[model samples]
Target: MASAADNPLGTYLRDRRTRLDPAAFGFGGGRRRTPGLRREEVASRANISATWYTWLEQGRGGAPSADVLDRIAKGLMLTEPEREHLYMLGLGRPPEARYRPVDGISPRLQRVLDGMTLSPAIIKTAMWDVVGWNRAATLLLTDYATLPPDGRNILRLMFGNAQARARNADWDSVARFVVAAFRADMTRAGGSAAAAGLVAELSALSPDFDRLWRDNDVVAHNEGVKRLHHPVAGPLAMEFATFTVEGRPDLGMIVYNPATSADAERLHRLLAAAPDG
Candidate 1:
């Protein structure tokens, strides 16, 4: 059987406590032995025994019940994601369960993607899983449909594979942006088993990923530029834009297109000449 020390609940509690500010929580600053709220403080706020809280922090207490955790979440003033994380650590739920998806892409939005015949557009899940794309996107980007399930993760491919590196001209900047974006998602979706699992997998798979994850950085995937070495079109520079799905909050659609008229013409010619594969 796994001990409390091995459990994620304890670690989650410890991490959260350490991150809280006394001023933010309306606590007075005095010469203190520890940085954040003491175990007794959390226990008192949550209406629990100090010993129980201490034992929990020490990784010796039994798993906390949902109701009990709710009390702690309230005491800690946890955000929605933070509350979900507390539950996940105490219990176990996938990350997708924690966040309500935005309004799924409307037909209007679908039409927008379809209208951009010269551009590449793809919709991806919160975990960067590709959900949908237009035919032009498929043609412009590498044949992502042909890749194996695990290999399809854009971040995984960017960092883990040499072939992907060879195709991108500005690999370093792209890598930084990707890591920052992923870190942002992890912050919003922290404590999810799926998200945690993804982080663990990436950390183990690439040393660059391990270094970047340790930085504790975060950023939204709003917009960016990418230069790709297409097999048929050769090198092309493109600007990318991202839009969140309205109903499906967990989905983000990103589109890419050549930044210059000449590049656009080159892309059209290449696509026209390309053989059906």
Candidate 2:
């Protein structure tokens, strides 16, 4: 049989607790038996009984509740990845998302998006806010850099901007698809509260938005052909694909590639004409 100290959950908890600095967390230390905080100190920080904490370390404590584990994780001063690991150890799955806004993507992710030279690529938040885009997106799609932050939202651009509507080959079909996909994507990303303000505002402003939202239809933003009537390039058909950013459930990437040689040539010409954008 495995030793009590060999329990995976207990081992993980003990390891993380030992990794914490007692002095940094305002715990006074004169002479300590161990390198890290004592079981009592950890228990005190976690707001649990010291005895129970001891039981947990010895693998005698029953499975800890998610709430208790959360408290313990906070007490340990765990980072997001560490907290997630704690949840996975304590519970059988990861915890629910805390629903924070994504300010920006990492440099690696930005590089990945930027690497798509001819392919228009954009990184968007769960709430459909365009947080990052490549030069191809500016040349072939919308000029995201020129727009203010709020104006970069996919939903806002689709419904609020007349120019965006005119650019779509079939605005009604595209709008419906976007609304459905938005519903599914936001829900999956646990962004309902963040999306609520935009939802309410758009519903009040656009009857189409109100109707589509009420329909309660949901669609996956998988792969599809998008037709747009670009002012500079004329009618263009592009095949677009969506991908979830690795380790980032709150962000999604969409890449659009020209469906035909003619469309590709048009995008190339458009890119060549745009001066150092």
Candidate 3:
């Protein structure tokens, strides 16, 4: 079933291999005609046989397994997107989602966040890790920047952080819904090892998490009205909607709009009083 169109995979791998600096792989002193790591060197780094890797680059090794492709990706120092590309070209599918902490927002997305001056907006991964937020979001929700990268997880903060628990007007109901939504996400990810590990860690940390996870409840939190007990602004009525970012199904953008004129006025005052960064 192999076609010439898929030849790009072999070409891409070769290009990546040639671009890798040999010095980075501790081959600084060796005399080499090529500017990058040799094929055998890459094979060694990827922990595969030279013959197999050569065959792979020659497009004669047939389709590679996910694990092998992943190793090659690491060996070549591919970015997340590059790794995904390598898998797609080599295996005709993307690799399963793994837990890796990311706190990056594209410049375009950052601008979108900045534009939501009145509405609180946040960008989260499929695993519910808080990666980016606007000023309003920090004022309403917890200040994601203040939390450790790993601690920015919505579920983790909900269950373990006292500050987050205090911000919720209805802790019990919100916690149940959060757990259910998280369960649904985990299920959709095919119950990856990373998801299971997160569940295990949370289960051990919070009794509530343990109970809810065991119950096997699942739901999608597409949109809802949330009552938040803001520390400075007091009670605020907000309607939030979740949207999946185009081309990045792994990310969701949640925006919170004030439900009433009074709430909007209060948010405006709070934002105005705060120093602009």
Candidate 4:
């Protein structure tokens, strides 16, 4: 028999409670004892019995079904990633019921990345793992591929590693954007093992990450400016465009190009001059 401490339902409920704000949920501000929403509030919002909800919080309830967990997630106002995390924890369903990993890229997508000769193009997983990159990307960004398998996370590289500061010109903006993007993904995915693992790993490694994660701020990554101190090109100011690969939910393609004609020429010259390694 598994102990209540090992119960995923209880763990999720507790984590959710820590994430909620009383004022945002319309709870009266007074001499409140608890840190977040009350059990009754969560239960009523979820349309579940208070006793049963309590059991879940106490780690007494077994794994919940997808439908039931979805209701709870809705009641808690969880984002997509958060809901997915709730499910992955065995509080709801298996990975098949949730997300599918992008096993590989199609030839068309590969060609697309390769076709952008003047721009640095790359593909990444939801967890920020680099799935593929073009030759131009290698010349533009140094040591990106040299990272350890699990060290490919942009957030981790930016916050946990000091070397990133030298490589990136606007580290502050980059950090904020990445953190916000991560928060957005968390909401979208509902907190799968991949998400949780990344969060845990980053939190443990970086104090700044721990502080930012606790803020509970959420934002999506769409378009942004990328300032890189390219070894060959010198300082390059680029605009980044990110697009989701259709039929591949786990993969996203990001392309970077100079914002101006002059910078574009510089990028072209830089890539041309670089030795084909």
Q: For every model shown, what is its TM-score relative to the native structure?
A: 0.59, 0.85, 0.69, 0.62
- For model 1, how does the per-residue alpha-carbon lDDT over 116-233 read when each residue is reduced to its tens digit? 7778898776677665666677787756668775666788788888888788887777788788897776566444677778889999999988888888777878987788887778
Can you tell me which runs of candidate 4 are displaced by over 4 Å? 1-104
- Model 3 bad stretches (over 4 Å): 1-6, 27-35, 101-112, 123-132, 143-153, 160-173, 183-206, 218-253, 258-277
lDDT (Cα) of model 1: 0.75
Candidate 2, overall lDDT?
Answer: 0.85
Best-to-worst order by TM-score is 2, 3, 4, 1
Model 2 bad stretches (over 4 Å): 1-6, 43-69, 90-98
For candidate 4, write residues 99-184 as lDDT tens digits: 44554567888898888877888888777777678888878874566767666667777887776767899777677678878777
10 residues in a row with least lDDT, candidate 3: 94-103
lDDT of candidate 3 over 178-245, digit per residue (tens): 99988776665556677778889999999999998899888997999888898888888899999976
Which is better, 1 or 3, measured by TM-score? 3
Best by lDDT: 2
lDDT of each: 0.75, 0.85, 0.85, 0.75
Lowest summed lDDT across 10 adjacent residues in model 1 is found at 94-103
In candidate 3, list every pair of residues with a backbone clash. Answer: none
State the number of backbone clashes in model 1.
Answer: 10
Better of 3 and 4 by lDDT: 3
